[model samples]
Target: MKLKQLILFCILIHIVSFTNALLRRCFQCRSRGELGSCKDPFRFNATEVEDEHGLATTPCASGWCGKVIEGGGTYSADDFDMAIQRMCVQRGPDDNEDRCAYTVYNSRKVFMCFCQGDLCNAGSSFTASKSMFVILTSLLYLYSRWNQY
Candidate 1:
């Protein structure tokens, strides 16, 4: 009976460790800016009217930018937009012509839309924060289970 229990405990520890490693890898992938670059010069399709003088204002597009892996991956820009929307209210004027720009950083990978921009941005920070949360949660769960043993 003791041997059986030991085996079970060992198995549980292995499982937890494996899961933790996997989660950490995923977190690193998202946080390290390894995936891509920011799409630069993200322009608005239409000119906007100024609030007071009716002058043409510099058009801007409200969108999240992040890095994506090369040779295709499961990540989607729409999913990133949804996640961002969940976190914060949309910025800028509500214009249909406004666009969100995404840049894939890998030299080998080609993104269908959005021009290349600097990788430094709010989205990268958000990604790192989220990944840290996931890693911490996984660790907490493992710690709890270990204590129960």
Candidate 2:
């Protein structure tokens, strides 16, 4: 009976771990000075961004990825200032559900986009190591469960 209970507990733990692995992950980066991969015409590579830039991806509890462009020019202007930011945005229930939006904040022109995809804030894709870990852990637990039977 204890063995059966143990198996059930292991299965529950695996389910919870795997669910956490499904959280939306976004490339957490920002433009610096006049050079950065996070700027317009964003360029992203899983290894390069993680290794060369030394930036880590962030998991969003809200399941939303966001890209923010802030500048001093008008929305119609061709020239602007400041930096771009890629981050996880927590959206409230009453907030706008639109994919993109334009607004003015503190006299700065801000263009924001919210997406429901992993790594959607950047035009790139990456594999989650946590998911792989969960898979391996579950397999190990199953192996032990069977060996006892």
Candidate 3:
């Protein structure tokens, strides 16, 4: 490839590699366990903590993890427990028209979402932070042009 093309390709590769979503085995926990009280938040597997802490949520295999917090009770009625659940999530394949239905709002006050970045679903939004991406790309462009001659 020509010098310009080669430089562009290198920059693209750098951005793509760094910006690519990270894969991770995140810590999964929830206020309501599969069983009952005495569940440990730090217990990620059977080997870690006692079963009394309920059970460790399944690890994220589809490339996402998340936390759901809902109020007004499970029924969305007044005066009830607010449920908080955190665990792995799969947004769905990109081949589909909608890569991910990140959020779904039902008639109840329930809200759900998913993320792609590693541990991004840890009670935060699904999308990865991009502020640095813009600045870095701009800088790369300037640097490449200056060194072109």
RMSD of each: 17.9, 6.4, 8.0
- Candidate 2, run of 10 with poorest lDDT: 123-132
Question: How many backbone collisions does model 2 have?
Answer: 0
lDDT of 3 by residue, 1-149 (tens): 37766887787678766655344444465564333431223334334634545435344667665556555344655423555565676654355221323244445455554555555444333334453467477868877686766
Evaluated with TM-score, which candidate comes out highest? 2
* TM-score of predicted structure 2: 0.56
Give Cα-based local distance difference scores for all models: 0.32, 0.67, 0.51
Candidate 3: worst-modelled 10 consecutive residues by lDDT = 37-46
Residue pairs whose backbone atoms clash in candidate 2? none
Per-candidate TM vs. native?
A: 0.21, 0.56, 0.46
- Candidate 2 per-residue lDDT, tens place, 61-87, comes to 877777877763546344336678888
Better of 1 and 2 by lDDT: 2
Off by over 4 Å in 3: 21-27, 32-59, 74-80, 90-110, 123-126, 129-132, 135-145
Candidates in descending TM-score order = 2, 3, 1
How many steric overlaps does candidate 1 have? 6
